[model samples]
Target chain A: MKAIVHVQLKPGVLDPQGQAIAGALASLGYDEVTGARQGKVIELELSGTDHALARERVEAMCGQLLANMVIEQFSVEILD
Target chain B: MRVAVIVFPGSNCDRDVAEAIAQVTGKPPIMVWHRETTFFDVDLVILPGGFAYGDYLRPGAMAARSSVMRHVLDHAKAGGLVLGICNGFQVLTEIGLLPGALLPNAGMKFICKPVKLKVTRTSTPFTGSFTKGQYLDIPVAHHDGNYFAQKDELSRLEDNEQVVFRYENNPNGSINDIAGLSNVSGNVLGMMPHPERAMVHGKTRGDGYKLFNTLMETIR
Candidate 1:
């Protein structure tokens, strides 16, 4: 099974890269771009047949290595 | 003082920090790799400033998850002295060892220059050498040094007097001009300035050296 995790800064936490990207987009004539928040995407391949087990492993991974629970929030998805 | 400097793959300031500690404390610091699981009986552990893991994904974000950090966190929890500079500070915050995230400069520019910082509250393990309101000129080189925290958390920090240093000039738009902070226990210190780089006589007038000296005096 394959799993994907997207980690992002908590809503109130500042996102400098996202802000910089938003500014660059505006400068390049892309007005109407309201905001941008940068985040990380991780793809993992697991040797599990059960989706629940895969998700549990993914959650453990996030707690251990995949995401920093302090300032980041992560969501995982199982893929075929 | 027996010290250990944690060296991540992309850490560029480890040697400098080690040298500064050696110069002031008369003992060279051990260079520990990021993969190490133990600290090996050290009194002070420094997470020196640098582009750890090339500052990939986020500043100090990747490095915070390194294996060594687990040991570092454990050490801090056990009342060990931990000092995190610039990139080190980012890592500390990323790992939740310290409060506040270092946001980009309000101007969205990489700021590299000497800035004046005032010793706000020195009742901690890190700033006992300086008097309250004393100013030290230290060099800050970072794109993201602006510190942010929730309002209640900020109030809690203020109530506990965990704020150790504040910028004299407010160069980075940090809340309340905060430049450095300590953990609630005061054993963990995370600051954005490069005190090790400012240890030389001519480089920064040695104000930064006082910080190390102060720590040594307390620990010894």
Candidate 2:
């Protein structure tokens, strides 16, 4: 089984990299881009056939280490 | 003072902090590797600055889960003093020893310079030497030093006077200009400034020296 986690800064949190990227895009003549937010995507491979158990485990991983609950939130997707 | 400086793989400031502690305490600190499960007999445990684990996932994320942190957590639980500086501050936040998260600098820059800070409260274990509202000029070098906490938590920190230091110039856009924080019990401290880097008298303001000197006095 494969698990994918998407971690993103919570709403109202400032993302300087995303802001810089938006600025660079505007400088490159992309006027419609109002803003951008940056985040991380982590992929994991687990030796489990049960999707439910894999998701539960991956969410635990996100809570424990992958996503910082104070600043970021995460969503886990399981692929079999 | 019996001190232990935990050394993670990429920790570059462990020696500097150890040296500073030795100068103030009249004895060298024990350098504990990250893999050590026990902290042994020590009055203080220090997490110094550096890109621990190459900052692979997040700053301090990997190092916070290392073997030694369990012991550090236990030490803090038992009312032992723990000081986290720079990336060490990041580790404390990661391990939930302290509240809030240190976001990247608002300018998205790796800021390295001498900045001024104001002492918020002097009753904590870390800021006893400074007078109330005293200003300090210390060197802060880090990319992620902007502190963030939710509204209620921020108010809680303020109400309890858990905030020890606030930036004078708001260099990194930290909310409420918070530069250092103490836990509720005031036994643990996490700050972004490199107090160990400002120990010289003539060349630098040496305000950082006062922090160590005062800590020794308080512990004694």
Candidate 3:
């Protein structure tokens, strides 16, 4: 089984790299972009066969390690 | 003081910190690897700065879950002094040993320079030798040193006097200009500055010697 975890800074948190990207886009004449917030994606390949169990484990992993609960939020999706 | 400097997979400042401790306390600190679960006879524990675990999955996030951190958490709970510098501060926050989180600098730049830090409180083990509100010149180098906390938590930290150091000038957009903080018990401190690095040049009145000297006196 495989699971994909998307981790992102929560709303209202300042995204510095995102702001820098927005500025560079404006410099290149692509001024329509208002903002860009960066995050990360992690794909985990597991040996478990049970989808429900894998999802549960992945959610636990998000709280434990993948996402810093204080600053970032996470969403999980099971791969088909 | 018997100090122990914890070395993660990519910790580069462990030796510098050990040397600083040796210079001040006259005894070298024990360098404990990340795999070791036990630290022997350590009165103070330091998580030195570096790209621990190559800054994977965010700075300090991976190292917070490493094998030895379990022991570190226990040590902090036992009221042992724990100091986290730069990346170590990031790890302390990631592990929930300290409140708030460090993010990329607002300018999106990796800052490496000497900054002024005012000692907010002198009661803590790390700052007891320095006068309250006295400024210290310490070097800070990191990509993610901007500290953030919830509004209410900020007030709580203020009300409880947990803030140990505040930046003389806000360099990285840390909320409330917080440069360093102590836990409620005052045994653990997490800061963005590198006191060890600043120990070399002693011309500035704000140099980091008094901080280490104070800790040595208190522990001994």
Candidate 4:
């Protein structure tokens, strides 16, 4: 099984990379951009057979290493 | 004071921190690697500034999970004094040792310059050397040094007096202009400025000696 974790800074947290990207886009003549926030995505391959167990493990990984709970929120999805 | 400076794989400021500690405390600090399990006998643990793990994925994210950080977390939990400077500050936040995250600079450039920091609180060991509201010049060098936290968390930090230092000119667009903060117990301190770099009398543009001096006095 494969699990994908999407981690992002919580609301109100500054996203410098996203802001930079937004600026770059604006410079390229793409206006109407209200805001941008950057985040990370991690994909992990697991040997587990059960999908539920895989999800539990991925969530644990997020809490332990994948995401910083203080400022980041993560969601895990299982892929076959 | 016996100090332990944790050296990550990509850390560039370990020697600087050790030199500063030696200059202020008259004792060279133990240099511990990121993979080490034992922290040695030390009163203070410092996560020095640098591009740890080349700032891969996120600043200080990879280094935070290294073996040495487990010991750091344990030490901090046991009420040991831990100081994180610049990249070190990012690592602390990455490891959940401190609240908030350091994002990229608002201008999207790697900033390397000296800025004035106002000491908002003097109760912690980190800022015991400075008077409240006094400003000190410190150098900062990082691509990601803009600190961010939720509004409620910011309020809580203010209410608990955990907000230690504020940038006088708000260089990086950090929330509330916060430059440094202390943990609830006041044992863990994380700041974006490089106090270690400012420790020398001639090199530093400001009175950098006070940071180490005050911390040493408080710990002693």
Candidate 5:
């Protein structure tokens, strides 16, 4: 089984990296890009065959360590 | 009082803090490496400033999960005094020992300078010697020092007097101008300022020296 986690800064949280990226894009003549919020995607390989259990484990991982719950939100996707 | 300073792989301020503590307490603290799982018997545990784990993942994030932090958490739970400064403060938030998250500076730049801070209420294990509302100039050097928390938590910290220090001029855009915080039990404290870096021998006033004095006095 495999799992993927996407972690992003929560809405209303200021993202300096995203803002800087957006600025760079503007300087590079990509004026149409209004903003860009950077996030992380983590792919995990697990031995579990159960889809539900794998999803649960990944979500738990986000809550426990992968994501800073106070400032970021995370989503989990399971791949079989 | 017995003090222990935790040293993570990238911690650069461990000796500075240990020396500051020693100057005040008249004895050097024990240095515990990141791999240590036990804090041994100590009255206080300090997490000093530095780029722990090279600030990877997040400032203090990896260090917060190290074997040493597990022991630090246990110490705090047992009502031991835990002080985290600068990057150490970031680790405290990451470890969930302190509330809120420290984001990038609003201007998105690394700021290093002395800033004025008003002692909020004092009378805690960290600020027992300072007068309430006293203005202390402390040096802060970090990239991500902006403190943020939900509305309710911010107010709760205020209502409970857990806010130990507030910036006199809001240097990093931290919410509510919060510069330092203490756990509800008043045993754990995390702040962005580098109090240890400001200590100087004898002439009696550089700004950070007073903090170490107070910490040692409180411990005594």
Candidate 6:
């Protein structure tokens, strides 16, 4: 089993890197690009066979280490 | 004062901080590796600046969960003084010992320069020697030093007088120009400035000497 976590800054948080990306896209003549928000993806490999147990463990990981709840939120997806 | 400077694998300022402590207190601090769980006979614990864990995952994230941090948290709970500088400050926030997160600079550039700051709170042991509103010239070198917190929490920090330092020029777009802060209990302080770099009188202004000097005297 594999679990993928998407971590992103919360809505109100300022993301300078994302803004920079948008600026770069505009400079490259991609005028239609309105904005960008940067985040990170973390994939984990699990040995467990149970999907439910894997989801629970991944959620635990997100809360403990994968995401900083103070400024970022995370979503976990399981792949079999 | 019996000080202990915690050295994570990538911590580069541990020796400078230890040297500053020795210069101020006349005793060199014990250099404890990140794996060490015990900090016996230590009154002040310092988390020096550097890219711990190569800033992996996030600045200070991996180091915040190290086996030794559990003991550091215990020490903080027991009213021991903990000073976090630059990357150290990031670790404190990551561990939830201090409120707020340090985001990358608003300009998205690694900033390294000396900036003017004003001592906002002088009641804590960390600032006991300075007059309220005293100005300082401290150097800051970090890529992720912009501080962020929710509006309500920011207000609470201000109301409680936990904000100890404010940048005169708002170097990194930190909310309210916050350069340093103490926890509500006033025992743990996390700041982005590198005071150790400004501790020598002839080579530098030695503006940071008062901070370390006052900390020792007040704690002693």
Residue B173 displacement in candidate 2 (angstroms): 0.7
For residues B50-155, write the lDDT of model 6, one tens digit per residue: 9999999999999999999998999999999999999999999999999999999999989999998899998888998898889998899999999999988889
| Whole-model lDDT, model 3 | 0.89
The candidate that wins on DockQ is: 2
Model 5: pairs clashing at backbone N, Cα or C within 3 Å: none
Ranking by DockQ: 2, 6, 3, 5, 4, 1
Interface root-mean-square deviation of model 2 in angstroms is 0.6
Q: Candidate 5 residues B110-200, lDDT tens each?
A: 9998888999867677788788988987889989999999788888888898899999888888999989999998889999999987786
**Model 4 Cα lDDT, one tens digit per residue, A1-80:** 88889999888666667888888889988898877888878989889689998898789888887787767899888999
Model 4 scores a C-alpha lDDT of 0.86
Model 4 residue B22 CA deviation (Å) reads: 1.5
lDDT tens digits by residue: candidate 2, B121-218: 89887788789889888889999999999888899889999999999999899999999999998889999999998888687548888998888888
| Docking quality (DockQ) of candidate 6 | 0.87
Model 2 chain B: lowest-lDDT 10 consecutive positions:
B200-209
Tell me each candidate's TM-score: 0.89, 0.97, 0.96, 0.91, 0.95, 0.98
Model 1 alpha-carbon miss at residue B117, Å:
0.6
lDDT of 6 by residue, A12-60 (tens): 8999999999999999999999999999999999997999999999999
Put down candidate 3 lDDT per residue, A1-80, tens digits, no spaces.
78999999999899988888888998999979989988989999988688898999999999988898888999999976
lDDT of 3 at B55: 95
lDDT of candidate 4 over B1-220, digit per residue (tens): 8799999989999998898888898989999989998657678999999999999878999999898888999899999999999999999999888888888887778889988999998888888777999988888888888888877887888899898889998888888899998999899999999987786557543456778888888878
| Candidate 1 residue lDDT tens string, B73-182 | 88898899999999999999988889877877877788899999999888887888789999888899988899888788889889988888899888878988999999
Model 5 chain B poorest 10 in a row by lDDT: B198-207
**Cα error of candidate 4 at position A53, Å:** 1.1
Docking category for candidate 5? Answer: medium
Per residue, candidate 3 scores C-alpha lDDT tens digits across B1-107 of 88889999999999998988998988899999888966566889999999999998899988998888888898899999999999999989999899999988988
In model 6 chain B, which range of ten residues has the least summed lDDT? Answer: B200-209
Q: What value does the lDDT take at residue A37 in candidate 1?
A: 96
**Top-lDDT structure, candidate number:** 6
**DockQ: the better of candidates 2 and 4:** 2
Full-model lDDT for every candidate: 0.88, 0.92, 0.89, 0.86, 0.88, 0.93
